[model samples]
Target: MSASRPVRRVDRQALQGLAHPLRVQLYDALVSEGAATASELGRRLGESSGSTSYHLRQLERHGFVETDPARGTGRERWWRATEEDLRTRGADFEDDPSAAEAYRILDTEWARSRRGRHESWRASRREWPMPWREAAGESTSHLRLDVEETAELMAEVVALMSSWAERTDGRDGDPRYRSVEVQANVFPNGRPPGVSTD
Candidate 1:
């Protein structure tokens, strides 16, 4: 949340490197788990250790992750996310079809990750206290705005989210504290019924 690390803006090369579903899965695991050995991540993702290690090195080459020296041993290496957050702008690859395809693949993986998390939360909600169960749910809103306005709104929301992230970092010692996932997205809707732009 309040990570001292800067958000890494992924370039096309990195996007291509992460396009594989398994690599995307491994990257997410490394970020969420803080640090992990290839074997540990492999177990979580149902992949072989050799495969995970190969993909982890692929991530390292693209600067998405790195060796966690403090957590590594003589026989095993630990890896961690290089950045607290990562982002890519599809428009950046507008002229390159291959890069654009890579972006799409990564996007699909991101959506899958979100769906998995949502399902997991729903499945486990019963184990949580009533207060938490009541507080956890989805909210949706639709607004009409020009491109500039939409950009401004997204920036504001990100700032607000960052503030909360900063505040929650040191509360791990609290018995009642639990990690919560926050997802925010705003994009232009595809052609609605009775609308045409072609």
Candidate 2:
């Protein structure tokens, strides 16, 4: 199972060959960080330039991203996502086993990355003062909301988070205030006893 839940849905054709870890990471980076070059991606991701380029090609094959003319890089290629959201219909993923598996793998990969970051953040949390560390909370419950309501809530949450990200100027030139990574997961805290919704 994936470590984290998938946010965007992708189609069968788009899911093809996207199971690979590198390709999934590249796509997530592009989706989360906007556009970047092979070298920049390599530097940020700690992967080799050659490997970044290779996975980039795989991403292009899957129609995940396309080169931009505005930020020309001569030898280096810059990529941006084609769609705002990765949307998939019932037949695209549910009807195709391979595509479903690919989606699962991608979800797992993303979860792994998210877990790592969460761990790192938790570890570093103590370094900050109590005032800063005490500003967070956790929850455990079963959310009962209709699909449309849930989607609306998610959209509102995303907008609230993006409002922070969109800010150009923040607390000094400090790194944390300059940029922040937000991970929002709304789900049950633990398994309920002997209850299978399935």
Candidate 3:
């Protein structure tokens, strides 16, 4: 999980646009589903087509998403998240009241996810028809490295992960493996115990 290099940095305008609850949900839907038409997105979010389309245009205007690449013959615009991940200064965002609006986006997204899972009893935990499910595992290791070493290690990890993503191109995909969910992160936990990991 530690090795993949991030491809782009999301900036303030993009963050601000994604700050809206509907837009954020739209973003998540696009990212998870790969691409969706405005009408499809509207139905998924329980909003009207006009509303979804307007916000989608706003998203495109700000470059949060673009026309999905696979639609070669169609005239309909399909949208998806533009960047590899959503990023922000967590501490800074938490400190300012205005910045806290971003949390609304996240909260609404989570609520929607939960609502979809339990929308009905038959569809409760029993439902395997949902488009996707998530799972994760974590590990920690102690390391002593200067700033330069830390940077080098991160870059090497990214290269290795990208190489793996590349090498998988030729592999046979099981029908189940068509959807791949992978996330990797490495960040400072500050000085570990007594040592100045600073």
Candidate 4:
């Protein structure tokens, strides 16, 4: 993905465009499930095709998605999420009230979506194959690291994931294999042990 396109630094306008709940979900579905027509997405998301199509256009206006020519026909159009790594700098919106609010809403929705997806997976894990079930689990650890170290560690972990991701790109010829979802959360606790705020 890095070789293909540069990272997309989402600006205030784009961030505000994606602040809509349905639009965010549509973008998420496109990225995770690959390209699809608006109708197909509507079916999967239990929304009207008209509604999905409208929101898809809105997403496109902000460069969040684009037309997928290979998947389209005369009467239908397919869309795919951009390969760019979308990022927003919180500091940019620190002084702007409106932009900050938009950022807060989008950020909150993102976190909520992650939690919801994980909970859904937990609920449905039993239906999956035994091998997958055995391989899937979560753990919590208390790490000793400052802010900068934590960021560096996360960057390393992302690089590792990017490498692993290349192996699963394109069609799945092997029924024995499945796309796995990996999630990680790292943050600082309020002052480490024996540290005084004063």
What is the C-alpha lDDT profile of model 4 across 28-88, one tens digit per residue?
A: 8877667889999999889999999999999999899999876778899999987676878
Candidate 3, overall lDDT? 0.64
- lDDT of each structure? 0.82, 0.69, 0.64, 0.82
Q: lDDT of candidate 2?
A: 0.69
- 13-97, model 3: which lDDT tens digit per residue? 5667667778877876776555788888999889998999998888888777888676534757777666454445455567656
Q: Comparing candidate 3 with candidate 4, which one achieves the higher TM-score?
A: 4
Compute each candidate's TM-score over C-alphas. 0.85, 0.62, 0.57, 0.85
lDDT of 1 by residue, 1-198 (tens): 555536678887778899999988888776554578999998988999999999999999988889986677799999987745576888998799999988888889888988898898889989988999999889888998888999999989887766776777655436777667888888878775688787
Clashing residue pairs found in predicted model 2: none
lDDT of model 4 at position 3: 47
CA deviation > 4 Å runs, candidate 1: 1-4, 169-177, 190-198
Instruction: lDDT for model 1, please.
Output: 0.82
Clash tally, candidates in order: 0, 0, 2, 0
Which whole-number lDDT from 0 to 100 does residue 194 have in model 3?
Answer: 80
